[model samples]
Target: ARDGILVVRPDSGELPKIVLDVLESLAGKFGTSNTPTGHKLLPPKIRVIQGDGIDINSLEMILKTMTAAGWAADNLAFGSGGALLQKLHRDTQKCAFKCSYAVVNGEGVDVVKDPITDPGKKSKKGRLSLEKNADGTWSTITEGKGDPAKDQLVRIFLNGDLTVDEKFQTIRDRSNVGL
Candidate 1:
């Protein structure tokens, strides 16, 4: 009846139903109360974390279900298992890798389109490079100006030939990104 902490993790089953079921189970065991905002609050000593079958929609649905049932949002946590990003297609973010700028007929040209139907579909123009701002955040700039030697972007290939290829693991390690 005495301990440091207790965290119940449920990683299997359909998310929307399972999450609510777990919340009800916890309430039945550890009990719950109404918050000042009139939402059900779980006992602070215990909490639940769900880690599977979660996407943006599912996450939103879970939270909505919890709130509808009077459960506080703090009663549970979610782990996406990288699905949040991995499951996304380029179109989900409105990303199109078309050549926004290119050299044509020995002349520099800025190419872009601002569709009247969807203004958000407008793309950038001219050559682009990421530059570090004075506040340490990155901003995309057209027509590169920073010193080529110091900037972080590296050239790996040119002219349809692999110039600086590395193993997949090496690339992941070098970029410090995990998937």
Candidate 2:
């Protein structure tokens, strides 16, 4: 790093221990300095990227441990894989689908799941559409409300047939990170 080459990776073992050991070792060898906020920072060319066995809690714990060890948060970078795939924000929220609205005997019924004891079970009523507002932020417009023409929801399947298809690269390019 002193010569401006950065190539460090930590893939196995206990994440926090490995990260702490590597950082301390680097600091001892190349030295460190305190940032304006008093966080210890290592030389710019040398750093560690923890890639394996990384979960949300482990990531937070690693950062906290780094902070407690007087190391700056920027000294480490993270790669996402099984940890991200297995533990996602959607899983934490316990997301589920319920019939929030239905047409019974030609009568529109606003159905909602609300338990008297658990407010967390409460859900929106009517239909939903993901649309982008004029301000350029995407939002879930409920109650069968939204400009049908500009709706972001794509009709990928219809009547037991897949209507929309694209190459893997095309799909990947359409992700949020792509734009």
Q: Best-fitting candidate, measured by TM-score? A: 1
Q: Taking the tens digit of each residue's C-alpha lDDT, what string does model 2 give over 58-131?
A: 89999999998888999999887655666554325656667676778988898987754357657777777778
Model 1 scores what on Cα lDDT? Answer: 0.74
> Which pairs clash in the backbone of model 1?
40-70
Question: Against the hidden true structure, what lDDT does model 2 obtain?
Answer: 0.77
Candidate 2's C-alpha runs over 4 A off are: 1-4, 87-179
Measured by lDDT, the strongest candidate is 2
TM-score for all models, in order of appearance: 0.46, 0.45
How well is each residue in 47-138 modelled by candidate 1, as lDDT tens digits? Answer: 88886657888889999988887889998888765567787554457667766676678787888866544577677887777665666676
Clashes (N, CA, C under 3 Å) per candidate: 1, 0
